[model samples]
Target: MKNYVAFTGLIGAVGCFLLGPSICHATENGGTVWPLGVQTVLPAILPALGETSLYSYTAYYKADSFKDNRGDSAIPGFKLENFVQAVRIVHTWDVTFDNGVTLSSGVIGSANKIKVDAFGSSDTDSGFQELYLTPLYVGYSPSENLHLQTGFGAFVPLGNYDGSKLANSPTGNASYTQEFDLTWFPHPNWEVSVAPTFTINAKNDNTDYRSGNVFNIDYLLGYRLQSNPKVQLGLVGYYTKQVTDDHFDHGDVEDGNRLRKFAIGPQVFYAFDQTSGVALKWMKETSVRNGPKGDSLWLEFAFPL
Candidate 1:
């Protein structure tokens, strides 16, 4: 345990440098929590068999995005509508200790392509983006049935960002995110997991715009069908609310602004074998305020090594 503890700090610094400069902000170009499916969260549990384990995963998501309308209700140009597709890959490595605790870290990069339709014509924006970097993670199990995880994810400026857009989180400002995760297995076939997170943002030096701090939660509840590890059915959901006010260098926005949304959906997953697994989920924003109101779907694939 002591040796692994020392190793964690050693590797953490290297991970930070490899991930690139820290203050860049390419926030939610696509959205949060891997599109919400509890059945498929990565590193579902810490491994006990090896010094380290590698998990490579891919997720794709689509969403409808829009901004506040400003004109005639009958005119379609009154509001801008956009459809965004994000393809992301996240690589994470976990190191296990003699005491069974695990330390995980990873980097995520993505390609986002958005199509905007307005006034009977459409324009598009596409670019490769640096999404996020998880510098460290600590996992522990206090009981056979309970698992806990704590980590911080730094939101860097790795994506294509332009401050002129009506609304885009990824193209916004830099932020530091903190996360707390808990999973419980009350019965052999039942499991529940929840992760709550908070984010703090810094002013965008390029545009002097600062998005509000945010609070969010990701949750999942699952039950195995029969007794096989090959298949499981579950429910997943997420809630995101901006707790602080957004500000701009412009004097008009000095008062600040905020946004919030909630969503829920279903999840299904299956393991092809011990080496690979896949899951599918969909979440529809049931309510929204000062934020994009739409639905999102996620297709997740994971490989363990």
Candidate 2:
């Protein structure tokens, strides 16, 4: 049976929205469009030929501190909470290349609710974020235990956005992303994977502020229980770094205001059947620079449709 799994890019964009409208003005951090820590299990695996599946994800993020360039608390008395829900639909075509590569396509839709308490005031907003479309995704299995994947996707601004609000919409900007991934089954019970992604941003016409490009790496180490092969326990993590400088209509912002962060935590997955499962994860952020520092909880479900 083909174990189908897909990416849910929800939290990074949702969290960026909670950071307020002025991404490069108050906090010395550049915003990003890729959701961190969302790809925890079976990241590089693809569905079987002619298979279709649906993946749903829910995430909650909370932060009480905004780190500065020096990684110190930049915003005092700052607190933020965000809830995100996203759905992904994936379909793998029956066609296979002579080189043993299969093709797939997917789309993602998301909604978010964000609340911020800062500067002795509180603000909240809730709405759809963005629409992500993956027109081209490729997968290859060189061996029974090794799988590789690559894909391209674009984000369309389909949510609400207001430059004046403290809690704005995550769909304020459109972006494009490319990703590469690999999964290794070192043993029948052990799985290890690495998925790295890069995102390029477009100018937010509302603010005329262009965020820098972001590079993120997500990794996983999991072990399936012998007693119950349906249960898997793992540690999942990610590292995010802004590679380019934030830009205005004129030029790059001073010092770039690059954002960087690292997170790691525990995750558990329970398989109800060969093609249906539920996953839960908690990620604690650390080594943050020019960004919010906090933790996030994620619940995800995957099933064949």
Which residue pairs show backbone clashes in model 2? none
TM-scores of all candidate predictions against the true structure: 0.73, 0.92
Provide the overall lDDT of each model, using Cα atoms, as 2-decimal numbers: 0.49, 0.75
In model 2, which regions exceed 4 Å deviation?
1-30, 250-252
Candidate 2: C-alpha lDDT? 0.75
Model 1 lDDT tens row, 218-301: 777888787685687888877766677655455433224354567788888776765456677777765555434455566555
Candidate 1: regions farther than 4 A off: 1-99, 118-121, 165-170, 227-229
**Clash count per candidate:** 5, 0
User: How far in Å is the alpha carbon of 294 misplaced in model 2?
Assistant: 0.9
For residue 57, model 1's alpha carbon misses the true position, in angstroms, by 5.6
Worst 10 residues of 2 by lDDT: 1-10
Candidate 2 per-residue C-alpha lDDT over 1-305 given as tens digits, one digit per residue, 9 for 90 to 100: 23223233333332233444344531222345677887777887767889998888888888887777788886657777878888888899999788889898999888888786666767788877878889978999899899899999998877656665666546577888998888899999999988898888887776666777889998899999999999999999899988887776745466777889899999999988877789889999999887778898988888898
